[model samples]
Target: MSTEKKTKINGINFRTDIVCYNKIGKPILLIECKSQNIKINIKTFDQLINYQSSLNANYMVITNGNKTICFNIKNNKINLIKKIPLYREV
Candidate 1:
């Protein structure tokens, strides 16, 4: 995991853990990964949502080794996509 200073509508702060992005700059994607040994549940989803909200990212993803859930925020509504959604699709 890598940490980076990010700015959001709320404020600026350091995000301690996040999956690395393919590119560096402008818009970013926040990925939350879970280990196979751990069980995924609503709490984890809530945490991901909070982080996504704080980061103000256009796209967000939560995944275990087997399953993945993606969200796209547009027009102030969150749309859950079947796969990792792109910014253009948002």
Candidate 2:
């Protein structure tokens, strides 16, 4: 991540928890890490969803060390997925 780019998402300035980029420096995975005590809910998912318009990451993930959730974007629509694709699959 750079200080210049990706600093503002959806017009709101905030730092992302974790972002995994590919060789070309395109954001492939956007993750939001939370404490185990924090419930994984719509609000948590929304946080990552809010980044889509700006980041355009292919996958969105939220994990709290105990449980993990993953979603994939296709045709500009978001869908919950059972497994995340490997780098080659992307």
Candidate 3:
């Protein structure tokens, strides 16, 4: 993450979290990091989605130590993208 970039998220902000932005400085994606010891669940999923919507980001990602899932937003709908979101795709 860029130290100069402002990363004020609606919910709790994780320092390790990587939130990407567009050329205009609009938020484009949020990548959430999960602990390896804790199992990912629905509550965490909802929280990530809410944060994404609040930020008006085009994509959101949730990741544990071993795996990652990307949610792509389009037409006001969220669809899971099997692969990581590319900055150029936005």
Candidate 4:
């Protein structure tokens, strides 16, 4: 697991707030954190979706410290989940 992980997509560099990898060293999750004052919204989801292509993540999360939103990505589709899953579930 790492925070502020740097990644590159299409020649552009991005810093994701948190990234967790699997035993083989492939990123399995990507999380973006925001201050409590900021609410998670469509734009926030879009940003994570954009990052997903390069990260090849199975899940994406956006949080504002108070609230959290998790998404499962499959076939390039995003589906919202009620909560973040336990590490064992991932």
Candidate 5:
């Protein structure tokens, strides 16, 4: 896992909070962290979506320390998931 990983996409640089890679060094998951007071909503999803456009991660996660939401990205679509996958499962 790498925190605050920087990547350039479409001539813009993005700093992602948490990035996990596969054995081949391909990004598998991207996570964004927020304070527990903040609620997870569309704006949070939108932010992750924008980051995904740059990172091309297979999964996206948004959490406010209390609540977490995960999404699976496939074929340019985002689907909500129940929980984050275990490391071994990933």
Candidate 6:
């Protein structure tokens, strides 16, 4: 797991909170964390969404300490995932 995952969008870079890699070193999971004061809303998902498309990660997660949402990225779409997969499972 790497805490500083960098991805670029329109020439600007964004840093993710956590990123997990697959056996081949390709990104598999991307997680964005926010302080309790930050609300988990559409805006909170922006970074995760950008990383998923750029890194082509299989999963994306966004949390604001109080609430968390998991997503499975498939065919360029984000779908809700019921649970977070273990490292070995990914």
Which candidate gets the maximum TM-score versus the true structure? Answer: 4
Regions more than 4 Å wrong, model 6: none
- What would the per-residue lDDT of candidate 1 be over residues 1-90, giving only the tens digit for each residue? 245445353464535246434355534567877887766689988777777766566777788888878777888887887887554554
lDDT, candidate 4, 1-90, per-residue tens: 999878887899988889998888888889999889988888987788788888888988899989888988778778888887777787
TM-score of 5: 0.86
- Compose the digit string of candidate 2's lDDT tens values, residues 1-89: 33224458657797778777888999898878889999998898777788766789999888888999888899988889987678787
List candidate 5 stretches off by more than 4 Å: none
lDDT of candidate 6 over 1-90, digit per residue (tens): 799757687798888789889878999998888999998877778767777778788988888878888888777778998877788876
Give the higher-lDDT candidate: 4 or 6: 4
Instruction: Report lDDT (CA) for all predictions.
Output: 0.66, 0.79, 0.73, 0.86, 0.86, 0.82
Which is better, 3 or 6, measured by TM-score? Answer: 6
Q: How far off is residue 33 in model 5, in Å?
A: 0.5
What's each prediction's TM-score?
A: 0.65, 0.83, 0.78, 0.89, 0.86, 0.88
Q: How accurate is candidate 5 locally (lDDT)?
A: 0.86
**Candidate 4 lDDT for residue 52:** 87
Number of clashing residue pairs, candidate 5? 0
1 against 5, candidate with superior lDDT: 5
Better of 2 and 4 by TM-score: 4
